[model samples]
Target: MTTDRADDRNVAVVTPWYPNPQQEWAGAFVQAMVEATAPGCDEVTVYHNEAWLMRQAPEEVEAAREAHRRLLPVALHDAPTVAGARLMRLPVPTVPDYTFAELAQQHASWLRESLGGEPIPARVVHAHVGLRGGWTALENARPDARVFVTEHASFIDKVLEQPDSRDMYEQVLDRCTGFFAVTDVLRDRLAETFPALAHKIELISNPISFEAPRPRPVTELRRWLYVGTLVERKGVGWLLEAFAECHAGDPELTLTIAGPGVLAGALAKRAAELHVDHVVTFTGEVAPDEATRLMREHDLLVHPARWETFGVSIIEAVAAGMPVLVTRCGGPERTLAGIEDAVGEMIDVEENSESIVAGYHRLRDRFPDGLDLAKGRRVLDERFGYRTVAQAHYRHWFSGPEAGEGAASGGEEA
Candidate 1:
């Protein structure tokens, strides 16, 4: 199962988003994966999708500039220190109202010039997300070059909203040599959509590097921390309502929401309307280190997401020795299942005021002592640590059958 001179093998990690100083969660996983695979890899090149060039909005331009500034330090950090890891910034603007075929053509051209013309050939292309990066990876790799795709979320829901990307999902699947899903729920859905590619789909959870355990005692005034984008899909509005209800009886209860998104203004208004604005504090988009620091101050981590590919936040919380309250719609539920202390009591995804209130009450009654941070941290170290998860991925993507179990193969149409 071991490849001789593994450090000599080259891999190109492709993604649309990467973390900058502002702490974007784009290629964070890819960065973690490369570090884990370093022992068995010679070099890892990160190719980012610079589709922001297509954005003409003044606001988007400002955001892009900020993102670039934040990313510059990490980009430079990766350049020299990390062995076998390189960052390649490719700015490929989206075509104006262009179809996937047209977008693919533009991406292919970018790859031909940026990657295809490189002095050294890449043995494998690993893409995060399904459509754009995956399409570009397939186009850039040699015919027999290994292509691995990790489905982080449901792009079909996002892209198929437009008529042009109607068949984009299938096209991307057809080109991938193997597909990786963050949750079994997503894998099953993908299997149904493209049965022909079902066999190639493998369920893999997000890898989290375990942090130092921080154990806090359960107290009367429970501190609940919600970290993620303050958007509708994250169920922040409902969470606020529930918190208001909880605060009515227990005024000591406080909810700290970290992260920024389009719905920030609405969420703030909703908190005021619910009269819980005093109890809820918004610390817009903190860095990972700061987020972890905030997590340490809280007793519980509540993730009321409507949909998620994998809840890296949950894993991060568990690693920090915190209990989680996640909705049953996405990847976090599965990660919770692996931990005995956090199983069976997931929040309902319906995520209305009633459901949120009910979930809060249920948790309050069940674990008044708060979740067992030690047990949760143990679970994270055993199942989702970056080293173990990355090794699993390396076996699945690079070494073939001899590495271990081969991911399911073949495609099934939905």
Candidate 2:
């Protein structure tokens, strides 16, 4: 499938977070998608979330500026420009951030101004998430500009957790052009709420860069690793409980957790209560290299997330040829299908000691000597590898609107 329109088609890829050297998996897939899609098109440009820009340190900020300079083709826009191929970063004010509603409104105004007098000839405006950047795209992109939104996780879920933001979420969803849920579970839930856009929805799993599986030497002590935000939804509490049960029987077992969130103190307390604090290590947030090193060293990767749209870490572990024990939540279940034996096991999200112990026993029984790293690696390469997924996306991109219609058929309710 090809488009003569391809040469004229200018795409603006927008995201709220982007991975840097300091924070590896923080929107790392966005970086991969832009790099992959940009080269194939006549022009591809990227826009960053200015709200997040304020949180970085001076050096990190400078590093991001330099990265954009080297990688992206266009510049940040004071106002939108009319060009055949251009990447324009929408300038958002650093203050008066009252709420998500306010922020979206501010962004909508900025997007309108960015386009200025120029008509947006954009065939597609691909947004990384549905709420923030996606809302802005829906608001300002030319009516004909198809808006595609990828829901990485439940930003709405996060908002609903706070008593103040529930109404604001409804507004955000209403403005989305088409929704992309990372997992079937998320898609179903969204479909229940917005049946009108249900047919417009699609399932797009996050992609991983497949590497030749490097098997690590069988470690003397079986190490387990968990990487993600140290938050409630990640099921850190459940993981701690499960780890405690598993470690009680096997005193030599060790666990390492990476990433930062507000639940750090609560998780620490839970660990102490379970009396597994001695064996558990929390590294807060670490560099990507360090996270990968820990994954390689570990015998199994445990992700007891209560809810996940897609667990990129599970894919990363599979790519690294390590087994993963994930909850039968959103993302992990989708990724673990078919390759259940070699990669890892999925436990119930109950986060009980029995469930955790059972999950461990399941892993031990399936690969009593430990998983075949080679087999695990092969699974990831065939299914989740970036090149394969990228090709799928490229087909979707140039194939035009009807492609999405066919892809949307037989779509399960999530």
State the lDDT of candidate 1 residue by residue for 1-414, as single tens digits. Answer: 353323225677777666665455445666566666655555678776656445567558557655654554454323532445777666565536676556766665565665435422566678877777787787777655678888776444656555556476677788787788888877887788778778888876667768556655445328989988877788888888878888898888889989988988888898898888988899888776678788777877888888887778888876776667778866766776756455324766893877877776777676745456567677667787866776676665555542222221210000
> Candidate 2, residue 36: CA error in Å?
3.8
Which candidate number has the best TM-score? 1
- Roughly what TM-score does model 2 have, to 2 decimal places? 0.76
Quote each prediction's TM-score.
0.82, 0.76
> Per-residue lDDT for 205-303 in model 2, tens only?
666766534455543336888998988778777778878877878898888988888988888888888888888899898765567777777787888
Task: For candidate 1, give the lDDT.
Answer: 0.69
Whole-model Cα lDDT of every candidate shown, in order:
0.69, 0.66
